[model samples]
Target: MSSMRLTGTPSWLNIKQRSARPGGGDDPSRGPQEPVRRVWAIGGGKGGIGKSFLAVNLATVAARAGWRVLLIDADLAGANLHTCLGVRGGNRVNLSDYLYDRVVDIDKAAIDTSVPGLRLIMGALDHTGMAETSRAQREHLFQALRKLPVDLVVFDLAAGADRATLDFFLETDEGVIIATPEPTSIENAYGFLRAAFYRRLARTMSTSPIRDLIREAMDRRNERGIRTPADLFKEIGQLDRGEEARFRQALEDFRPRLVVNQVRESEEIKLGFSMRSVCRKFFGINLEYLGYICFDDAVWRSIKERQPLVLAYPQSDAALYIRRIVHKMLGT
Candidate 1:
């Protein structure tokens, strides 16, 4: 397949051409049906933590595995996934168009990537207002995303623990948090995880009283003295004994995956395990330590070339580790 570029015409809307098997991990012998779609969102609390790089390479690896993939750059203000995939930026329709009602169908914003079986929906690169869309608009976007025709949809979220980013992360089948071993990144990761867990609990609770209590707990300096999710659960149990079961269920459901990036030493990889332990003990949330990627020069080289590391340096150590991470995610 040739690389897709934005032209003066509106023909980019019909750019779905797969060079590999159409169905993702489905039995081709069976009768035709819609591919089983899976969604994963990659996010973090700190900027410059390599979330986009990981998202691009992960989508490429999945596409190479014969899964039709749609990678969406959900980072409205900091959009750069298109550049990562070697797609030109100018005059192209993007996610902002859909949110602002400039485009009626979400598929119209999806442009073909150089990688076969993989396409990209560029973020609202030049639209600062996109970061402040209403909840209704976001809901509409999520609903439209579900109907997208693809085996997998990966969202590269904007950095931070903002409500919009967290909502996108929580809505996906698998939410992966990417962080480095730096002290600041680790701290922000914990903060992001905390915000996500509280958000989940607030949404899970039906009673206004319980939700108000959760909101109180979310404030670090609140008079309630609720410093952690475990503390919040205790208060919830005391406030409404019948809600304990629901609270526990919410805790059981919020399992976010972690990926430690740019590891310079073997000891740095253990950060994932440490964060997992902290989440289990303090927040009562089961954070899965998906895997880690070691620092490699090939990563920078591929970025300079504007190609995915998996395709540009498949033999490099970082590339091997990335493919391993993808396999672990797919259970293959």
Candidate 2:
């Protein structure tokens, strides 16, 4: 189909188009109705870690697989998914407009793209007070998202663990954290994961007195004098068995998947496993190592051409790696 720009559409119209779908997945009548499973968010603590690249290509592959997809560029401050998808058009209404103007509907801001089975909601260029979405707005967005008919909605989140990003990440059915093999990226990825868990726990137990106790325990330094989450969990376990059980249950439930990007060598690819181990050993958290995307020139070429690598070179190594990830995610 032809690609449409985000420049002049009304927010409601945008949402309607994005929610439209041409169905062709597994047979719908043979068994129980598969619940509409839209809304996947892609995020990372560090920038330039291939989060957006993965987001675009993942959406492309999902759409190509016959699942209607709505790709939301939730990185309001630095939205660029449209560029990666080779979309052209100045967005008239973005996430910023929806946030600032009470009358603007977020759905109206969404636009159609050239890729069949895929649609997009662009982010605002002027992100001036749009960093943190209010609780009401977030609820509105999620409620609206649930009503959409698309089979999959992918959000390309802004980098970092800011309150807004973390909140959005928590709202999704699954979250994918992207990181490179570099020490800095690895550390930041861990930090982001911890922060996300903490935020989620805080929200779930906002009224609990143990919240303060857990926070204080997390602040303590270990024998090596390094403050760590595991140390805090152990201390909390000693202090209150019930709280510890709750904490462990929360940890077990917070399964954030990982993607090690930009791997140049076999050793670099192994970093994904190493990082997964560190997360389990140090933080008592189990992270699913989704898969690795090796460093490939085709990725750079696709970026230069403003296209998704999976679309530009479907059979390339990078594309294969991404497809493996998709299979793992879908359990197919």
In the order shown, the candidates' Cα RMSDs to the true structure are 9.2, 9.3
Please give the CA lDDT of all the candidate structures. 0.82, 0.74
lDDT of 2 by residue, 126-212 (tens): 655335678787777777777666778898888888878888888874788999988888878987888888877666553366677
Highest-lDDT candidate: 1
Q: Candidates' TM-scores?
A: 0.90, 0.83
Candidate 1, residue 9: the lDDT equals 21
Candidate 1 residue-wise lDDT, 1-332, digit = tens: 11111112222112222223445344566322464357889988899999999999999999998777899898989999999889999979998888889999888889999999899989876857444988788899888877766778899988888888888888874889998999999998899888988888888899999999989998999998999888887888898987888999988888788989888876786798889898898888888887778778888889999999999989877787787778777766
Instruction: Report, for all candidates in order, the number of backbone clashes.
Output: 0, 7
Error of 2 at 130 (Å): 4.7
Clashing pairs in 1: none
Q: How close is candidate 1 to the true structure, as a TM-score?
A: 0.90
